[model samples]
Target: MGEGLDFAVKYPFSSAAKEILKSDGFSNITDEVVELAVNKIIDSLAGKSRKRIYISGAGEKEDLLAYVTARIILGYLRNRYITNKFAVNESKKVHSYLNEESGETVDRVAEELGIKTKVNDGMLLVPLPVFLKFTPRSPHYHLINRCITNGFVQIEKQEKKRMIEEAVRKHLERVPLVKKPPQKIISAAKKIINELPKQEIQATAELEDSHPPCIAELIDAVKKHQNLSHPARFCLAVYLIGIGLSDDKIIRFYSNLPDFSEKITRYQVEHARKRGYSVPSCSTIVSYGLCRANCGIRNPLNWHKGRRK
Candidate 1:
């Protein structure tokens, strides 16, 4: 199993690993087993294994196992670390905007921060987890950490506060160019300053009838004990909050889900409320196949304007 797993990691696109995994004894491989196998494979590839295991593609089962294992690991990695080109580029923009005074281009800053923003065609790839193999001890560790943690360079409260102070100090040291700093620097400073922690809002029960048709449909589905998809549930939660529904009321709405967990649901709803998350756009709703009514609008928030029934 160990040798086969190692082979899978080495030649992920091959079919040998799949054959081994699908064998009678191994056919019942659970997610836990696959995860363990993936970790082992990663360790072997990283040279962390006690003894190197040679993977020869000579045997049929060996080849099949290698392929299957590779696919599983790749899929897991893709889901965990892979993101679109737009997200990476957006992070680059944020990084560039924040460090403008440092006289460094976005690419240079990214390289200095050890952020790998590789774009091929329209796909953006960042080998985030692989960075763990090399010990990184740079002043930009926080920036790299953000790339890994948030999958983007979204300024968090603590970091934002630190950056704001640094910017202010820098400004104080320099002679005034005008009455204030350049608009670009001022905008960036304001952006960082606004990165405060989300505050909890008092939920109100008003705006039920004003809900967009899609949100109304989701609420009805939840009430009827129908299971909603993650995106659907998220949209509904955000819509509810946008329409002034309390966390408790949203919890009640989700109570009938087949897989409902009270603690988890409450936490998610409260988090959305506190963070002031808004409903997804009409296009997103349509992509989820949750948009039932035409509503003749681009935004879900506006769906209730003309039709309040």
Candidate 2:
């Protein structure tokens, strides 16, 4: 039933995701993450009892697809980690999301199915580029990242075979084979946070509920740069959270920027990395440094620009 809501197959990726990955500046990142993802696929396939797979697409219809995908993937990961095996639980009913009335119809179907739907706020909302035709880039694409984020969806502009494999490689590091030491890991995180510099701590604390400064800085910087170029800010935004800055912080910070565009937000972070800022530094120094980097450069207070436009 949930699969009716989530799984997407051959959902094309957005231009943003594609452009970012193609950048030569991000070459170093591509290989490392790809290696990790490949290993995960190999490990999972080595002992799988079934070859069954599920798929879906995005948009207003994507809401349903996203929901279904989350449930199926969650169930599969749970089985994989708990019993070291893959389990099949496919949904038989399917629906469409092509019209404006999809919302009410979907609500009606849910009531009829007797399926209690949970408002999965914990599920991450991934933004797919508008270019993707017929489907969305939900968790099924990057199973590794989806696994790491704990059933959370990842936003992407492209769907590359290598990238999905790479995402899986990074995902394995988080799973616990036995009794997962939750307390120990928390303590370790606290210790690591404490060991970080004061600026980093402050920046992290401030960005706990919003987009990181590195992202904002990247956008602001890209706007200044005449050349439409590398690392594509979209990729940077995706990568920033992976570095540890909280989403809450990212959103809150973005709220402050004038004329901020998600498109711009996406490209900046990727471009910044290509320019040599590590993820941590991008979140901390570059995000903050951009203000200083742009200091004293005045626009002379464009009082007439609004009227001219």
Which prediction has the highest TM-score against the true structure? Answer: 1
Model 2 Cα lDDT, one tens digit per residue, 1-309: 233323222111222223332442332323233333223233233332222243532232333232222322323333232111111111111221212224444334333323222234443232232112212233244234442234334433222222332222223222333324333333332332354332111133432333333444454443332111233333344444554445554443443232234466545544554574443333333322232333221221121233357
Q: What lDDT would candidate 2 get against the real structure? A: 0.31
Q: Write the residue-wise lDDT of candidate 1 on 18-82 in tens digits.
A: 45455534444444444344444343222232222345533434334432433344333332111
Candidate 2 runs further than 4 Å off: 1-161, 169-182, 198-304, 307-309
User: Which portions of model 1 miss their true places by more than 4 Å?
Assistant: 1-210, 307-309
lDDT per model vs. reference = 0.47, 0.31
Q: What is the lDDT, from 0 to 100, of the residue 98 in candidate 2?
A: 14
Q: Report the poorest 10 consecutive residues by lDDT, candidate 1.
A: 79-88
Model 1 RMSD vs true structure: 21.5
